[model samples]
Target: MSQSTLVSTRIDKWLWAARFFKTRSLATNAVELGRVLQNEQRVKPAHAVKVGDILEIHHADQVWQVEALRILEVRGSASIAQTMYAETADSITKRQQRAEYRRLHTEPAAQLQQRPTKRQRRQLDNIAID
Candidate 1:
């Protein structure tokens, strides 16, 4: 990379490089859907990115903050990608806790809400008639 280049890269490629998404296209779709922000401002997939920019990426029910350290135009393996940006520890903790909470709470209520199958429904109908 040239001194001035600082490896100027696209937002999608940066997201993938930062290990935010599994693929470049997924990152681009997230940007296009306004789920990615830079400095609190929404950005497009092709947005030019440089070092020190903070990205807020919304994934599922959680958000991730990544501070860019190096920019690259192409995606790399997870280990190499991890070197491109730094993830905030707080965000990871919050996401893990939220996931654990949801996992514990979702099952009981979901079981209650499950509709009866046709056989069960027929049994209920016969019981009511009898």
Candidate 2:
């Protein structure tokens, strides 16, 4: 087998090398925070990841479900990072649908470009009182 095929790395390190997190510390923190799961269960930073392992990662407001395709010990460019995993089709569909849903249903607070003025606040209070 090729060296690439034989290689493996820690889950947290892989996360950093895969560009999932900007730093190893961030990756470790996320793993510790339960934001990263392997096979749907929480994993420690030192847990080694092998190819074909399903990873459920929560980064920012988006969730990713990807299957490990390759493993690496060093962080690389974005293009290289993408080659490490294959995001499932179902995951892609779900994420797209989620984005569309969020777009269609924006938060009320987000709609306001700025905080309400004193007059506007009073009006809002009166409307709430009614």
Candidate 3:
């Protein structure tokens, strides 16, 4: 194959094609913001990536560790996207653990019914000072 048909592609584009980001701009922003790390180091959006390179991506409340397996220029179906990378076992375990923890603990904000009255607020402040 000619060099033009090679599998090498930009990291950001691959991220979008792999369904990690909804849009190219979002993928680009993630890289610029340092949420996407290649080989344990931050990389630019245009950084070239090849199969077998490890990518650490921080998305939402979890981090994903995936090994790139293919490079394409266009986004495809979710199943096809999944084939682009293989997630690490450690990442899978940590994600499941975090999900369980979140399920058990829930969000603290969810426990609040309404705004505290002034008297209750004052009581809270007083307790903090002790």
lDDT on C-alpha atoms for all candidate structures: 0.82, 0.92, 0.91
lDDT of 3 by residue, 82-126 (tens): 988999999999999999999999964576689978997888789
lDDT of 3: 0.91
Q: How high a TM-score does candidate 3 get? A: 0.82
Query: Per-residue lDDT of 31-95 in model 1, one digit per residue for the tens?
Result: 99999999889988889888888888898877888788887766667787778888889878887
In model 1, which runs have C-alpha deviations exceeding 4 angstroms? 1-5, 107-130
Please, what's the RMSD in Å of model 1? 5.3
How high is each candidate's TM-score?
A: 0.73, 0.86, 0.82
Which is superior by TM-score, 1 or 3?
3
All predictions: root-mean-square deviation over Cα?
5.3, 2.5, 3.6
In model 2, the runs with Cα more than 4 Å from the true position are 1-6, 122-130
The candidate, 1 or 3, that scores higher on lDDT is: 3
The residue-level lDDT of candidate 2 at 48 comes to 88
lDDT of 1 at 20: 80
RMSD, candidate 2, Å: 2.5
- Per-residue error for 62 in candidate 3, Å, reads 2.2
User: CA lDDT of 41 in candidate 3?
Assistant: 91
Candidate with top TM-score is 2
